[model samples]
Target: MQVIDAMHKITSHIRNPSKFSKASKLALQLIEAGSVKPGTVSHFFAILEAAMSSPGACNEPSVRADYQALFNAAQGVTECFNQQQKKQFDIWVLHAVVANDLFTDDSFVFSKAVGKIKDAISALPITTVDDDNDEAAALAAVESKSGTTHNNTDDNAQAAASNSLPDDSTHAAASNSREESSDPFGLDGLLEHKSNKSEKAREKTVAALNRKADEDESKRFLKSQREALLKCLEIAARRYRIPWTQTAIDIFAKHAYDNMNRFTMQQRDAITKLWNSIKEQQIRRKQGKSVSGKLDVNAFEYLQEKYSHEKISIRHAVGGGGERRATQWLG
Candidate 1:
């Protein structure tokens, strides 16, 4: 019989074993004796069913005996095949076994067996078409070229600068207020006597306050930008079927965090303008009509220019920008 026809028969026997008990028994004998050819569908299916099925009262000892017999029969057939073909056959058998529901109840034992089968296949030195080593190597190359070494020095400097600025501003403001309060004379006399000195002090204090506000705003803007970048990374990962790993997420997060200050003023402004344009375009895209030609320009390019100075990775360049990356953790 043809391999496909024989496989169909074997599958029918497995699905309704009691109805084909006599024929199954005879087929089992033929398989165990190695009288049937290797790679015949019936031979493989009979072994697969015996391996997966529960050993009931009438079938228990007979099935066990048949299993050992088939194993012995397979030894000669396996010895005749090349190492690559053997590995391929082993994987094919494993896939079939995994797909069968009969082994689900015996998962622990079956899982261990599957592991052993994989280990044996791995030892065969045959490279499969879908091996992941290439992708892993590519990612490693990108990481090396990206130059994302974390340095605590930059963080410490920023923190020290942040802490010192606020204290200095508060002290200067307090001193000025106290001096102004000490002047007890009414309007004109006090104003003319202290006007020049007070104006100089006020100017210094305002400059300090402006400096502190700029620092605070920059910090906040960096945080918001980082959050948006992460959201975009997650969406790209999902679209590409990449498995989410905590280590990968943290690596990307650290890269984003460390490089936050590298954004140029122009890039930041471009990003803001891009987001504004996106809101307008989204309304048009949803309404099923084109908007102004300016809004029709590449939104991605706009985001790239906005975030380009921040050294964002290609992985984070999707899902309406960084917002998608930030929210992926929730799901």
Candidate 2:
């Protein structure tokens, strides 16, 4: 997966150098008070950030898929979410996380503890953001619902009162009356619903087309960032006359991509980790270390495992056809 590209929209929104520093502070407080794992906190942030702007983002299937994918891709660090944390995630994420736990219902005290958080998420934003088409749609919806609906409701109530239907009737008659009132021309209901469905579908297709250009731009931006990081790694290896294969570069490139944000801090961290790996591999070569150390494998795998405490390993081998192969440890 191209991690950098996937995260560009979210990371750009955070707009800060430090990786979720504000959210991390809140998460630490939760950890000290509650008993969920540290990884859970990161998962919470990811769900919240996505939920802020994505429909069905908090749904069980979508949330679970994202959780699993990110856990595997991050090697359990939740690095992507960490890089893209926003202040908005602090409340919505906390509510979602706590609400997911079964133990929250264990006691009355737990009820009071999460009561406020629950209320906070209840009034979730209908549209947290959209720069163009989404914003236009939202505004149109608000105008349609708020402005015209109010006048229509007033007229409908007066008309209903003036033309009150007979109440004394059979139960079957009352049922038929209710159904007729709802449908009016009967086929009017069917046609209205069909038209509504078609309109919504058309709007969605148009919106998707509108977003395609922006998506392309984001991919280009991420590609540039990826190339820049890869070039830095190339320069570092060349300085020491090390053989940095394109395959190995692709491996470490992904790792660096995963942890990177547009922030200066993330860039700095990548460089530090890259340099440390370079130096470590040199020492390993000088000492004629383990099989992993002797081979021209990925430096990122070693760097992340040692410094970040992620459970990770990368294995390189020769295929039956003499092509290079590597096993990736996901989750």
Candidate 3:
């Protein structure tokens, strides 16, 4: 059977205590013989789990005994292998132990095992083999005790070329000298500085002109839509029985001011009609009729419904009649 299959069988048998003796014997023999592959480290932990879960298992004394036996078997196999093979084996065993959550407290044992493996590998003679050649013999000996082939001549030339570049400190000093010689009072420097200043001034002037043009266009638009928006506000306010205060007129003016071009000609006409109704409602409220505030519930509800379709909230309408408060209503 494949190694992973064997490991699974062993783990299963160990978890079921009736099969513990058979499984434990097989697992111990396989591990001791160093037949487990590095890729099967995960499977090794499965076996460990089974062993730890068996009936009468994980009792401190019994667990410690089993651990010692396993440790000894791994050490024996490690000693019998060549250095490279032994390192691979040790790595697999260490991975298995750690994966199983064993050897967490007793780090000394792991440290000693690592030290022995390192020493064994270090003692092996270095071989000279070029991996880039890729012949069958070289491939077979790839894992043999050997250091990589070194090309000193090419490395030396690369090192010299790297060292030949100017360092940052020297470059900075040279740049400073060039700057000082070009302009003493730095008037050329001052002109260079003023060039940017003039450019920024030009940009600011252009921005101001554009803003003024936009403001004039906005004024014309508001003048055009003024009657319509006021009419709409009046009608909406009166329909909801809300009073038309100066505050209400101001809110309508602000909406006209900000959104002059946004409304259709029809919408503008509707707004003028609404505002006239608001004026009538105000007259009624002043005459002691029971009317709501300047912003009627219906007007608020309309704005809310309209903006909701655009994902805008109506919270801004609470005290301000749905108009942004930063700017004057007509301005």
Ranking by TM-score: 3, 2, 1
Tens digit of per-residue lDDT, candidate 3, span 1-331: 4888888888777766556556667888888666665566546645654564321233233344454456446565344443333333333343233222222234444334334433433332221132113222322333352313321322343335335423445545655765677565656655557555654654554455445434433332232222222333333243242222344344543444344334434333444545555566668767988655444334434432332222111121111322212122111
Off by over 4 Å in 1: 1-24, 34-76, 82-85, 97-108, 117-331
User: Ten consecutive residues with minimal summed lDDT in candidate 3?
Assistant: 310-319
Best by lDDT: 3
Root-mean-square deviation of Cα positions for candidate 1 versus the true structure, in angstroms: 29.4
Please, what are the lDDT tens digits per residue for candidate 1 over residues 63-159? 3334334344454566544333343334333323222212323435434443443343233322222223422342344446542322232334444
Clashes of each: 7, 0, 18
RMSD of each: 29.4, 22.8, 36.2
| Cα lDDT listed for each candidate | 0.38, 0.35, 0.42
Tell me the spans in candidate 3 whose CA falls farther than 4 Å from its real position. Answer: 54-56, 60-67, 74-331
When sorted by lDDT, best at the front, the candidate numbers are 3, 1, 2
How do the residues 1-331 of candidate 2 rate in per-residue lDDT, one tens digit apiece?
Answer: 2332333334343223233334333333333444224434443444334333331132243243332233222333333333223222332333234323212223443343234333432332222223233324433545455433422432354335324422223434645655667665566556557545754654554445335433433332332233223333433233233233323333443444344433133233544565465556656667987324222225433332222221111011112222211111000
Error of 3 at 206 (Å): 48
Where's the lowest-lDDT run of ten residues in candidate 2?
310-319
CA error at residue 126 for candidate 1, angstroms: 11
Cα miss at 227, model 3 (Å)?
85
| Model 3 residue 12 distance off true place after TM-score fit, in angstroms | 0.5
Whole-structure CA lDDT of model 2: 0.35
